[model samples]
Target: MPNNNQVLFVKTPSASSIKGNMFLYERKNEKQSWKLADSFPVTVGRSGLAKDAHSVIPLNDNLPVKQEGDGKSPSGIFKLWKVFSYHNLQNLKMPFVQVDTNFYCVDDVNSRYYNQLILADTAIKDFNSFEHMKLSSNGYEYGVWVLYNSNPAIAGNGSCIFLHVWRDENTPTSGCTAMAKENMLKLIHWLDEKKNPVLLQVVEE
Candidate 1:
């Protein structure tokens, strides 16, 4: 399948790549080739890549796959579900959710809220654990939710995959893609709802 018109192509050179950084490229239309969007350096998981989608390459002893807390960035084509920020100052054409401490992405495999974003005060109180999404925090100052397993969560697959701000060029995330704040802002502003923007993350040969 082809990437949607607006594609964020993140390319990693190899599987055992110790350096988690990758190049981010963007393109406006499908008719045109992708262009280097910016110097938006992104940090992936320390363990490298995992097959997260249906089209992902088959796994072997040599290749890693995704499970809960694998610390490997999911490889596949996915959509940008929504923009979430810890700050209310986001200026964009799309609507963004101003997240608070109560906001959580449930990771409990047996809970009813698995792989779903729910409020902490909700009746679903019993869960193994969840990420306390805070935008004001250093790790999540600004972020956009990446639609990974949203349709129907397969327990123990993966959760809380997002595109957010990184501390610096040298930091690596648990299983998310992070970049410079300015570059994140540029991506936020450039993403249009009409174009159906999507993220295509692949491991390079």
Candidate 2:
């Protein structure tokens, strides 16, 4: 029989592999769906969530509008925003991971975005410093947002959201997801205007 090709694939984060980042791959057969592209690893949160769209947040800049209690990386669908690596930042590597710290969550309930954008200034005093630059765990500074209500509302309930390089021995992340250096690069490359690339983070139920 001729080899059959499938459309999509699925990957479930487990207790053993949650710390190890995962890669998406096309299915090899009809019976079997998507498989891990390789044996890479990911850095899961200490809380250990489960496989639910309500717990995955897209790093894009469209949907899942940020909310007051909405934690960063709130579970939901979002798109991959632009690239802001420390290698590309103002040329600095003070920290370790090459992350972006420019993004902010719109925490104002009265505003249109509410908790969405690294939004504009507000009358609130805390809002004033919202524009100030923040550093990533890796010391890099960048920003990313997403569409409204794409993933679940449980993505970043643990607090803080990010997609950066995974630590050696695959340490657990504070609440963000992480991967290897090479994988991080690959993710950046795969992301673009099309395909609407997104990161699906799931915890162990």
Candidate 3:
């Protein structure tokens, strides 16, 4: 149960998949009321140098840009940017674009969409040579988009950025953390224009 006036803290399983490790806390009241929702399965990120990056977008709400590399999840603190959902997913031709629904990969020194947020209305053809850039579609049905650092010049390692699913009921994420689809939807419903820039804490196990 996420509200506009609450900050969520997801405690990952330090070891095994146990219950009650995940709890919700109130940011304003400083309330100690913690509850456990044990209806979610957790998935860790692929291990490797790719996994070195923390703070990743959750799954379930989005699709992988392209299945390549190690496919490792990131770990770090970030903020929620916006939610992107399309109506005509099937009819949409290649590079289906929209406003606030598309993200340009800036990892590459070249590429028009590099290090820039592409509008959904723009035409994005040419995605064949993006080893350094990754244009992510869909805002995210669940999970918050972390604003790791406002200074884009210092943030964004240029790797994995997609709406991923939660790993387990209570456990930290491999690279990006996750929860159940229900919880994710709950968060999405409560998210608004003001409560953005969510601060996430991805603890290392």
Winning model by lDDT: 1
Per-residue lDDT tens digits for candidate 3, residues 1-205, read 2433344443333322222222343333224453332233444444311322333544222222221243444334344554433332223212222323354433333444433444434636534333211215222333333443234433234433433345454443434445566765554454444433243333334
- lDDT of each prediction vs. the true structure? 0.75, 0.41, 0.37
Tens digit per residue, CA lDDT, model 2, 57-77:
333332333333322233343
By lDDT, the candidates rank as 1, 2, 3
Candidate 2 regions with alpha-carbon error over 4 angstroms:
1-18, 26-39, 50-78, 87-103, 106-160, 202-205
- Report the CA-based lDDT of candidate 2 relative to the real structure: 0.41
Best by TM-score: 1
Clashes of each: 1, 38, 33
Worst 10 residues of 3 by lDDT: 59-68
Choose 1 or 3, whichever is better by lDDT. 1
Question: What's the C-alpha lDDT at position 23 in model 2?
Answer: 57
